[model samples]
Target: MLELEFTAEDMARTRFAISPLWEVVAGLRVLLGADEQGLHRRWAEPVRARIAAAKLDLTPLAALVPPPSPSVPGFICPPPTTPWPSLEVELTALRRTPRELLRALSPHARPGVDAILADPDRRLGELADLIEAYWEIAMAPYWPRIRTLLESDILYRARRFAEGGTRLLFDDLDPQLGWDDGTLQIAHRYVRGVHTLAGRGLILVPSAFVWPRVFSTTDPADLPVLRYPPRGIGTLWETRPSPASPALAGVLGRSRARLLTELAAPATTTDLARRTGLTPGGTSQHLTALRASGLVTAHRAGRVVLYARTRVAEELLNGAGA
Candidate 1:
């Protein structure tokens, strides 16, 4: 028998999706060199400052984060006990009814993503709030502890990306080398999510909420946990940067030609996929190749991953010899 039990809260969660802000962070990492270790090192101090300014009083929890690890750079050590609610409870709620779970965890507020990003003065604040809000929803039971770590992490990361992208733009990086519309769109989603949660009591205000999922690993104590891939597809790109393999170059060239020809006003992976009839993932592969060749640069405008041809790309595309 199909039972229909409805609650406004339940309805909201079902609609929950990955926040676009996450993708923004990803674009920033790709554009700059802050994959994991680089980000940790760059933002450690800023993170600590933000935490202190917020007066969240994380001194009690400081003892728990593991000492800096080269292998896991900036990774905090496991806590003795789960700080938030039990993982079992959180998981059961999520699995039993994903929608209800999202609603329960999500903030009951709306601050459109565009509204926030549009404001020059408030952009940083908006980005922090958005990142924190999403982390609050996704991290679930680990909220308190993870949030503390994240408050610092997100601020540092967002600043890095925004500032870094600004530099690239001013440097006259060929407009083609900048991120596309899709990435910007994804970023907007994140901005909206953050704004919505801010209006709700869920956001702590001044202190950002950090999403635990940003961390690649899980707490051993939170056993039977779900593990997702970390930011940046390290495996996709080799550890040491070098020229693409001949086979790889041939494949990338064919795709690049197609992508550039289709692009207008800088398109994102999704845009490219829809217009060029290539799968989203396939398009990302081509973009990665172009990125490796210094022929393109990608950024997260909102949610979508935007790819643009670099000056080098233009030269390659325009070379009379070609």
Candidate 2:
């Protein structure tokens, strides 16, 4: 059990963010041991084939992202934030990682650590280069789809936060997590202890890749980061849509019908556009029509507007199915 004691100020300061760099790093975990990350097997197989075909030297990466162990350093997977931080920005942050933090990593990682310490600029550059190459081979192609899933999760959580405040947000994050009396507890197989937030607050990051478990930054000195699997990850690899009912299509037209069915979960106009291969403006137009028809409702979460099927729309879909 990991207990994170929080103060009123800490609660107020907590924020949610999405990290592209962290996703790339977390995705590599699948490559390290595909069997262990069975949830992503469909995605991992092709990426594995590409890595093998390219003959990419993943030695550095393999060393960097080792199996879950208490010895592994938290600095490597720094807390991620919104606006999708660039690789360079994350790399710079990594370069600034305190030397004491590196000691916490696996003993096998000492050589890489020593190399970085010997010549910080050159070694860090090499590390960044490896990360870039790995991303190009494994993640860059599927990032847009991955980004949409992550954004949708954040939007959903934001609504939860607004509706019931922090307790609802944390409680719904994962079964392993709970909040009681200003203390957040996490059930972890390896870690057990009580940590005070000390006014630094926490950063909640929703990840599409880190499934089956929740990960937290090890160093308490750093701003605490909690990376957990987002809801609806089971559908991330589902590319083809369930065929829209002919009658529904006839009433709303094929495009509109398809959009309505896809809103089984809340989604932004951009998310719908990507999933349906429609232009953003075109998707927005269709959503407006659906909203006007009382088939869907839209809620603004931050700068993005999320659309969900109204009760009438759900009944319409169920009736069509029947």
Candidate 3:
């Protein structure tokens, strides 16, 4: 044994930052006690089974996952795989070796791996790697096909972590970046450590239908703006950018423009659904898609996910329908 030494404080500081998939992976890791050699065999079995059962193509999911990020400091890897799978296998393997492979590649991701391994709460710990790997795989070849689901998973997990009193800052610099509770807990611990670190707050921006009300009336330059008009048909965003600015009168047709017009009043998803004659799920799906695109935001009030048009939505709503 290397006689590993870590303090209670240090141990507590090690937070798991990842997607929900990591929770499952961490759970399985504990369920199977093998070192590196047996990990892939153990995890792949269940994951492959689930995918097979669901009839989901493994390829499209592979492309959207982001690549393994640079390693974090003070991190260490568990034993690594023997003959590591090719990049292709790493990207699309039914199981989690790709994420494990990712942790093996970087120190930051590794410490969380080790923390989960060391944690007594076997079930929750396992998910750490599963989430991390999920994100890593998003950048592989077939990502476009499942990007919506991936984005939803990322948002769902991120909200969970932030709600848990973790700092949970997305790599705002990287729009594609996401962090789960594991990462948020780690970030929280880090933030608490420094006596002088500044506290930050979240900026709640609405999604869909930019309107004048969403902007600060104090400054004209601060007015809500959009790169283009809405252009998709499904609950998911599938439209192309419009050639005109939000000021353009012909951004979208009449009905779609009406959707923006109604969003000036913040309302619950259920309320929006009732008013718009859309199914609850349909409304949520659209709101979630819009949230992902930075056009709208969903807020949790009591039990409802309220949807509001963001500044960009407000901007586009201004003249497009006028």
Choose the strongest candidate by TM-score.
2
lDDT of 2 at 99: 66
Structural similarity to truth (TM-score) of each candidate = 0.24, 0.71, 0.23
For candidate 1, write residues 75-127 as lDDT tens digits. Answer: 11111122233433332332232222222222221122223224523543433
What's model 3's lDDT at 154? 43
- Which stretches of model 3 miss by more than 4 angstroms? 1-257
TM-score, model 3 to reference: 0.23
User: How accurate locally, in lDDT, is each candidate?
Assistant: 0.33, 0.76, 0.34
By descending lDDT, how would the candidates be arranged?
Answer: 2, 3, 1
lDDT by residue (tens digit), candidate 2, 64-85: 6666543345666677644467
For residues 30-142, what per-residue lDDT tens digits would candidate 3 score against the true structure? 22331233323323343444345444442322222212321121111121122222233322332333333334434434433454435424422334333334333222111
lDDT head-to-head 2 vs 3, winner:
2
Question: What C-alpha lDDT does candidate 2 achieve relative to the native structure?
Answer: 0.76
Clashes of each: 28, 0, 42
For candidate 3, the 10 contiguous residues with the lowest summed lDDT are: 224-233
